[model samples]
Target chain A: MLKIDNLSVKYQDGNQVLRGLSLSIENGETVGLIGANGAGKSTLLMTLVGILLPLEGTIEIDGLLQDKKNLRELRERIGVVFQNPDDQLFMSSVYDDIAFGLRNYGMSEENIKHKIDYIMKELGVEKLQNMSSHKLSGGEKRIIAIATILVMEPSVIVFDEPSSFLDPKTRRRLIHLLRNVPMTKLIATHDLDMALELCDRVIVLKDGQVYAQGNAKDILTNQKLLEEAGLELPFCLQRIEL
Target chain B: MSEIKKSINRISNLEELTYRDTVIHRLPPVIKLLMTVIFLVTVISFGSEQVSGLFPFLLYPVLLMTVAEIPMRPLLTRLLIALPFTLFAGLSNMFFSKEAAMMLGGIIITKGMLVFVSILIKTILSVMSVLILVSTTSMNDLLYAMLYLHIPTIIVLQIMMTFRYLSVLAGEISVMYHAYILRAPREKGIKLIDMGPFLGQLIIRSFDRADRIYHAMKCRGFEGGVIFSEHKKVRTTHWLGLMIVSVVLLILRFVNLSELIGQLVIG
Candidate 1:
């Protein structure tokens, strides 16, 4: 379980990106964080991962309060897929990229090999293991990026924006991937359809504040509240025309 | 995401250089580095009077750079920057040497030219060898080679860290330069005074970025010492390539083919 309390972040420019936001995710739960541009979604994720420091707040992952000293272990336990896949995929080969995190954690060579192969196979991306990252298509790049973090075997997975730039087919595949991926997930995205399809619960952020939170269907189908928060209900939320 | 894309572009560009299936490109960097040192030593040991002898030694670096596909024009341009300083020293010799002490066309021409040539060749070979090494091997591999060559771990780590931050710093500098271009009038070249402030801002931002990177690396469990997870076996072809190059360079140091060709051309 991950719990964030009264979290706030402000840049040197004095722009507050996250405003006293509080949220929680239970074990094995899939939570979607919805917000428009500049709504502090990415900042919130970064703060949770310890990439960005919060001005005021407490983050507890699995009953242990988060602090700078134990940040390495915390980050190890929480696999974060950044909004941009390219920033994190820094190795020459796909195999090397996937094994990067594991190696950083000091995993044995044999175990690194076993885990990398196993994760790639599990993700249905074994064929791409030798392919250069630059050559991969957009959808393939996204999948490979996720695989890089997933191979680290974190207990919690946080995706900054998984559905961006993907075609409908790839988006559907990603939703399916997320649904089947074991471990707790906190996904921050603007795609309401993805949220409705994959998240068990939803948290709405507006101007860096949590505007609403509830079961996925209930929050997603509420046209009035979503509209006020600069969000629109997913097409799936609409009743049949007939 | 755009930032990430830029980094991916940087990484891809780095890998493309090493894709050649050549024996020289595959040699362990330490061996290649040692050989380059030897070449430099031989080139430097030539007597100041023997300009003809040094010409043969010139073939060593020239062939390497040509085979390595390093464009000579730019390399020469960089080497030429040092010529002005050498000319300053050579000019003093020309003006201040006593008539009895200086041989006609011997002391001023031979000794001065040789010293200048020696420095120029050393500078070019050093830079060219580094360029060749980096072009043919990944930065991580080069770092490993440095470690194997018994370089200080702290220095290697510093180099690796500096490299990691270089891209970040480059991006920041590019952004600042772009902003300056956008706001400043094109007719007046960037004001000389503005450069100071611009660079000052860049250094401050770079330090902040470095701090962030350090934290990020720490969070990702980066220990002080670098770890190469997999060990690759050294192949025989890598050794053979080194031996061949070394032999050819050694053979050329004594040859007067350049003088013979010059005479033939003159005839």
Candidate 2:
């Protein structure tokens, strides 16, 4: 389980982004975090991964509290795919980027190679193993970024803007892949259709606070709430009676 | 825009050449690195007027390029980028030391000109050797060799990260430049007064990107140091290759093969 209690984040510039927000995500659940620009969606995800320390709150991943002493342990159980694939895929080659986490955790070479190959094959990116990360197409890079995170086998995976720059075909493929992954996922995205299709629950954030939380169908179809939260109802459900 | 694109292409081209399958490329990075160091040391140890002694050192890069199937054009182009500084240093010798050192037919070769030629030769030999090493050895193997040689992990990590981020920084700058140009199309170049904020924005963006990269790395379990999982053992052939290259370089350093050949042909 992942839990955030009264989380408040203050940036170095004295901007308090997240304000007393508390939420809990159960294991094996796919939750969609929908919010407008600067709605603290990215900040929340960053805080979850311990990249941004909250001013007053506690974040626990799989029962391990987020702290300097428990950072390694907490990070080991959670993985984050940043909004920009370029930031996530830093190593020269795709194979090295995927192997980075395994090596850091001191996995044997043989096992690391095996895991990387398996993950790449699973993601249908086996041919990109030797290709430079920066040379890959945007879609290919997004897949490789996910592959890098998935290979680590983190229990809880967080994605910020998972479908931001993908084409229709690639977006469909990514949605399919995300649906099949059997782990806890918190996806922050602007693609309402994707959030509606993949997530079982939705948490709407308005100005760094949870405006509403309920079933995916309920929140996605609520045009009034979504409009107030700086979002809109999904096109498919725009005409459907709620 | 084209300049940025060309630079990004250069970075990729250098990396792509290292992936070629060849005998030189197959040589272990440690052995190749050691040979490069020895070649550079031998070339620079010659007297400033010993241009003939440095001629044999050319064979190292020539043999490697041919055997490794590397195109000489790119290497030469890169060498040109490093020549201006050396040329200035060589020009000073020409101006300051004008005493006659040798006779070519009826014309006198001044000591300064001879030394200048030697400097140019030394520069070519040293730069080409280093370029050949990089072209043939992948960055991964190079870092591993550095670690094997007991180089500080921090320095190796710096090199690795800098190389990895070069293209990214280039791309970011290209975007910023394009944005500036779009808003000010009539301007030929950024004004001197505007350069301060223009560069300041680039630096700020780069630092923000670096912070995010560090966070991403930390999320993937990067804890202060990098661990390479692949370990390659030195083979017997690598040792033999290293020995042969070292012996040939040492002989060239001490013996003037050019002078010997000239004497045999003309005396």
Candidate 3:
């Protein structure tokens, strides 16, 4: 399980971004975090992954307290997929990018290759193993970015806008893939329809606080709660005047 | 301006060429890198008046180009980009050093003219050789070879990150330029008055983007060390290739193969 309790993050100017937010995700659960702009969804995800040092709070990953001593292991266990695949996929080739994290852990090259091949195969991106990351189509790059994280064998996978730039077909494929990934997933996205399809639970953030949380179907379908959180109903849930 | 777009495309093309699988591309980066250094030093060591001596070194770039299958047009295009500086330097020698070295077919061949030709040849060979090395070896392999040879990690990372972000930086500039042009279609490029603010904004934007990239890298366990998971070890064949190339370049530098061949034919 992954846990964040009373987490607070502040910028250098001392403006708090995540305001004492607290949440916990059980093992093998997929949770969708939805919010409008400035709702602190991305900030929360960044803080959870240790990018933003929380001013006050605790983060525990699988019974491991997140301190400077164990931060490396915590990072290895919780993979983050950034909004831009270009930023995360820094290596020259897709294979190298995927192998980067594994190399940091000092895994033998033979084991690294095996693990990468397995992950790419699982993701159905075997052809992309040797291709340059920069050359990939946006959708392909997104999938490969996921592959890079998945190869690390993180216990929990965190995604920030996984389906933002994808076409409808690619979006469907990604949703399908995420649905089958059996691990804890924290996806922060504005794509409510995707959240509805892939998430078991959903949390809505407003003004850097969790305004609503419950079963995915109930919270996403609750029109009043979503409106108060500065979001519209998911496309599938909205009633058309026609 | 289209300058950013052209530059982005050129970088993309050169990087793409590195992905090809060929004999030259398969050569170990360390050996290839060593050969390039030796080739460059040998090419530059030639005295300005020894124009004929530099002629033989042309074989290295020419052979690599042919064997690596790098198209000539782009290669020469990049070569021409470096030509002007050397051209200026060589042109000055034309006026200052005008002692006639020999008579060729009843025409005066001045030492200064020889120096000029020698400088031109040196520029072409050096640029072409470096381009070939970059085109044939992927950036990761080259950087890894540098690390293997104990080049400071800081310098390699600086060079690598600068290269990796060039595309991102170019994309941002292209967007900024597009927005500027849209707002000021009457002007060509940024107005001189606007350049200050324009560049200032770019610097700020670059810092913001750099912060994000650094965060992403750190999240992936970057600890100031380059983690290259994919590397081909330097093997015996690579060592042999290095030795052979070095011997050949050195022999050409001193033995004057042309002179010896001409003597043999005449005798």
Candidate 4:
């Protein structure tokens, strides 16, 4: 469904973040991208959405290349949930935020309203339909952020740090939601346990390169590989088997 | 901390009031916006010495507020914040112009005082009318009205994004203020020496936030232009309300209602 070939991204001041990294994900697969801070996970996500032009290499989404000419169409097929819900939820009300993409696509108001109602109800945020973004709690904001993406009905969804700042119950709910979503999901997170619970495959990133890639359970259990990538084993797997 | 919280609450309270169901709230946003513009123009067009002429204009806001079922306290509080600048301008007129314009029971009313009062009345009436429009109409509706009026899409988007960012920026500033106070409990506010770094940090943080927001917007397929759904047609009642209110405003603008009432009562 998605392909990246020798992708290398750099900042304006000559700081290379992602260097010659290449990977591909098949349709209907869940992949987790895990690494320490500044692992280029965000850069990769932004590049895929055409927000940041990669320095070298090509990104193809459903056979459409990521470029200025194809950005609008490419973005239509990909939904992104930003790390900070504040950034994603820019509309005055939750309903508007969820309907933003639909409006951009020129959907009828009736259709937009129907989709928004269904999405908000599915996320159990119906009561917050009219609430302002800033007034919501962290968990509520996160759920609303997800709804904003989900309402777009994109074929692929990219999530950046979806579990951060959420309480345990809300975290569990998120895990459940991510596990059940049938679309192609590329989640970048530090929550190893969540990745283990939701991702079918795991890709470990270290210093702008793919250090390791394998099945989610196997990659997660490799303590030596994780430590080398500046990560740690999930808490549940931290102890040695007696 | 309390001050910041109060200001945040003040904004949300005003926003909440817009959702209340009432006749005025149900009026089309374009109509309310047009009424506000017409009211402001009429209030400002009066002669600088015609304070009594402006007195009748207060009815517009008062009637709208009553019908809208909006409380006056929040609107008045916001108006108070805007008064000082106008008050200062009026005070300058008091000091500069001293020609006597009227007499009442041996007391002189200078032309300066008349102008001052007129300015004050104009400020109050204009601000209150806008407050009524805002309190009764949601920001979403107002933006739609702007789009319906054929305002440029970029300008409308700028307004919407700026308003959304205002509270976000304010919340950030509030947190920074609390952190400052917590560290230097002996100080009232950031010291003048600290203002450089204090404000610098805010700008940097705001820039970073804006960058992320731009990326988020782009990811949602925002491509410079915004599309709005078709607006509802302006109805008969809207036309009638506009005509009646406008005619009354014109008559009051030309003929002082307060003087006519006094003449009839005291004759």
Expressed as tens digits, the lDDT of each residue in A49-70 for candidate 3 is 7777889999999998888667
CA lDDT for candidate 4 = 0.88
lDDT of 3 at A151: 82
C-alpha lDDT (0 to 100) for residue A124 of candidate 3: 87
The window of 10 residues in a row where model 2 chain B has the poorest summed lDDT is B224-233
Q: Candidate 1's residue-wise lDDT over B130-236, tens digit each?
A: 55666566666677777877899999888877766656676677677767877875735458888799889999988876665454344455657674535445568
DockQ, model 3, C-alpha based: 0.58
Off by over 4 Å in 2: A239-242, B227-229, B235-237
Q: Which stretches of candidate 4 lie over 4 Å from their true place?
A: A240-242, B95-98, B150-154, B227-230
For candidate 3, write residues B1-267 as lDDT tens digits: 388878867876787798788899888788888889999998888887887777778788888989999999888999999999999999998898889899978999887888889899999999999999999988888888888889999999898889888877887788899999999999988899999999898888888778887877777787778766467778987898788988888889998876677689988
Q: Write the per-residue lDDT of candidate 4 for residues A118-185, one digit (tens) a residue.
A: 88887778999877777899999999998888888888999999999999999999898888778899
lDDT of 4 by residue, B95-159 (tens): 99999999978999999999899989888988898888889887878888998888988899888
DockQ for every prediction shown: 0.31, 0.67, 0.58, 0.60
lDDT of 3 at B48: 78
- Identify the runs in model 3 with alpha carbons over 4 angstroms from their true place: B263-267
Expressed as tens digits, the lDDT of each residue in B1-267 for candidate 2 is 469978988877787788789988887889889889988888889998888888777777888899999998999999999999899999999999999998999999999999999999899988998999999887888998999999999999889888878887898888888888889999987878889999999999999998888899999888878555365678997889789878877887777899999999999
Give fnat (model 3).
Answer: 0.57
The candidates, ranked best first by TM-score, are: 3, 4, 2, 1
Scored by lDDT, model 3 comes in at 0.86
Model 2 residue A62 lDDT score? 84
In model 2 chain A, the worst 10-residue window by lDDT is A233-242
